[model samples]
Target chain A: MKKICLGVVGIVLTFFSAYAQTPQKDSSTYKSRKLTFDEANLVSSYYKQEGNNAAVTGGIGSQKLSDISNTIDVKFIKWDRKDRKHSFDLEVGLDHYTSASSDQVDLKANSSASHADTRIFPSVSWLIENEKNGTTIGAGLSSSTEFDYQSIGANINFSKKTNNRNGEFTAKAQAFIDKVSLIYPTELRSGGGGDDDDDDDYATTARNSYSGSLSYSQIINQRLQIMFIADLISQKGLLSLPFYRVYFNDNSVQKENLPDTRMKIPLGFRANYFIGDKVILRSFYRYYHDDWGLTAHTVEVEAPVKVTPFFSITPFYRYYKQTAVDYFAPYKTHISSNQYYTSNFDLSAFNSNFYGAGIRLTPPKGVFGIQQLNMLELRYGHYTRTNGLNSDIVSMNLKFK
Target chain B: MKLVKLKPKVNRLAVVAVSAVAILSSCTTVKEYQKNKLNDGEMTLSSRKIQKTESSFQSYREGASGANGGKTGGGCGCN
Candidate 1:
């Protein structure tokens, strides 16, 4: 009887000791250091426009054009030993466009190589975020290529959150070094125009732009948030298109010409408010000015209404107005005595309106029963300008995780 | 005459400054748990991903650009 009791007691003690030695699961301290796939997004859009103002035709011809664009971006995330989060993003975009005005580059030709073109742009970025310090730093490099143009861009950005995490400030600087092909109009070519199909016939000029941006965002309340943004931009080099034809009052035609340097300032504000469980209102406003004697204002509003937790509909509208630049004039309006001149209507005083609607779907299971597909959205917009330009666009986005 | 011309501009600036102060002073310190509505995707204070192409087109068509998280200049949108 005594041996049996001693054995039982020994077994109980062993069980208690083993239980005490086992480790408890604490998720707070366990972060995966390995890089993990975060998400990917694909966006596609088709746009068509019709107008009477075409800069390539001295701002008085068909501005008919159509473009199809697609972009894909993938992101990855990892945790470092210091508990900082690192993110990597890679993006690629392609655009194909056909323009009737560009086809008029050779006035007598029914069709020209400049009528249609394709563009490709790719960018990569890395960001490091320190949770303890509430700070983030990021840098990116981007490039764009087309038959007549090439651009290389670089940017760096930093952001910091307030101690309470209610407000944040960000600053960014960006630069682009671009080369534009000097594809002169056939009649305007100094030497007898070379074959359009020969790339060696064209020379490229440099155009560089630099900008600095600052922004601040704050959570005003549980249902409201706002942001302010400002940017200073400077550009130098050839600012006018080589192929654009400007007709003087005397009926003589020449290529557009303008000053090589410009300075611009733009200030913007954005606000988002949740009206209730079903509706959200987003609004934006901006004021812009440039040293070329251009001033502009823009206002936009959008309201998203949730019909269900997983589905929402959004309606939006925008209004914009701008004053003409000092160098802008209508076709055959410039005189020979003018030192600078352009027939580009985009630089002319005008008002524009854009209205659009969109639908978004995000389901817990998936967008369409595919586990990896997280969200899907579709949108359409119509635009009208006081200068008689009208356009329509349709876009779609798909997100996968 | 110069002061008279600048009067309206000064008034507009003062109004903006006053409104900003009023808005900031009304802010409440919200706890994390009470941020559910503000944390919603639609409530973000920046441009949405779906509006990317729209912004691009607008920038190209308009004389004014930048401060909207879109390209100020580059890549030649010369259609």
Candidate 2:
């Protein structure tokens, strides 16, 4: 009897110790609060286009242009003591473009300063999110600089998720304060010529834009999701470029002129549907209007086919149509008496078509044996406008984690 | 002029209301574990990073802008 009692006691003790060593089912979860690198993305693109209507040359010259652009974005994340998640994003972009039309800005000179230029933009944003409350707030500052223009922009955003966590509402406000340099055509330049310190010939004007955006996204089911976005934008000051020439019916040439203030509203809808295990359909539609008498409709659709869980091929098509703004007219069609007028073909009524295909690869082990290189995507697109403008673009994206 | 402009707004509102009603009625609560399809990279709601330059150029070339995750002014797209 003593031996049996001792054995039972030993078994009980062993069971209790094992249970103690094992984690409890209801224990509080702890997450690391340290900041850590999340991901980085690099995107690069090359674009080229050709047309006959050049606004800079009174809408009657070559509108040939080429641009090469690259951007890099890095993200980091951390958890605060209050258990709120914080995310930081840093991004920088560079674009180099050459325009034959811009060359015409100096009609008297060959290959002038306006022929080619480079622009640099950098921005940083931070967001704090409370997962328990399903709320987030963010702010960002950005700047873009080029030879003839500079802009500083700021934005703040807030988002809230529904109780069920199936829907979210977001609001954002943005402002851009910009300065545009007035460099008149060579022949148009009056007394003071090119000089480093001459404030006489070169002048600058301010252009300010403010916008408020609202959006709502909802998961309709396991396979379908949708979002509605709207923006109200207002702009004031130097709305037209000083070098864009306009030729009137009277055979006289002058710079483009537009109203100082403008208002715009655009509404958009996006929907994504997983058709099955192999295909996903993405669609977007937008309706846009502005006080300048411009109205436009845009529709885009894309279908991505998953060959494997890690690889996808997507094909996309877009159609856009817009009405000519009240102030827009063809070359030499505008009368000198008009208050506001532009020979820029972009403001003229036209339809455009864009089609493209892309391939994405995300290997389970890594991309090209590099564990941190998580994804790669390559895309090509061709765009054509009804007004005899055509362009092609090729882009690539690399994601590292 | 006011009435003419208001007509489009009214029509748009009606369309949105109907879409909202239809979507809400069809919505099924999806749990985290069942979000595999929605969480796919291709299912992201915003524009992709690769399309950044495309969007920029489109905004510059087109008369209409905004609501497309692209710039809404403040650049010298003089080309």
TM-score list, all predictions? 0.93, 0.91
How big is the positional error of residue A188 in model 2, measured in Å on the Cα after superposition?
Answer: 2.3
Model 2 spans > 4 angstroms off? A1-30, A191-201, B1-13
**lDDT of residue B41 for candidate 2:** 89
> Mind giving the per-residue lDDT tens digits that candidate 2 earns over A1-401?
23433453354334334433333222147554776666778787889999999999877889999988878788878888898989999998878889999998778767877788889899999999999999999999999998889999999999999999999999999999999888766666664323334534467789999999999999999999999999999999999888898999999888899999999999999999999799999999999999999999999999999999999999999999999889999899999999999999988999999999999999987688656667999999999999999999999897867
Q: What local lDDT score does residue A196 receive in model 1, on the 0 to 100 scale?
A: 72
Query: Candidate 2 — which pairs collide?
Result: none
* DockQ, all models: 0.80, 0.74
Candidate 1 C-alpha lDDT tens digits along A1-401: 23433443354334334434334322467766887666777787889999998998898999999988877787888889999989999988878889999998899877878899988899999999999999999999999999888999999999999998899999999999999889878899876434577777677889999999999988889998888899999999999988898998999998899899999999999999999799999999999999999999999999999999999999999999999999999999899789999999989999999998999999998776855677999999999999999999999888766
CA displacement after TM-score superposition, residue A377 of candidate 1 (Å) = 0.5
Instruction: Report the lDDT of model 2 for residue A66.
Output: 93
lDDT of 1 at A244: 90
Provide the clashing-pair count of each candidate structure.
Answer: 0, 0
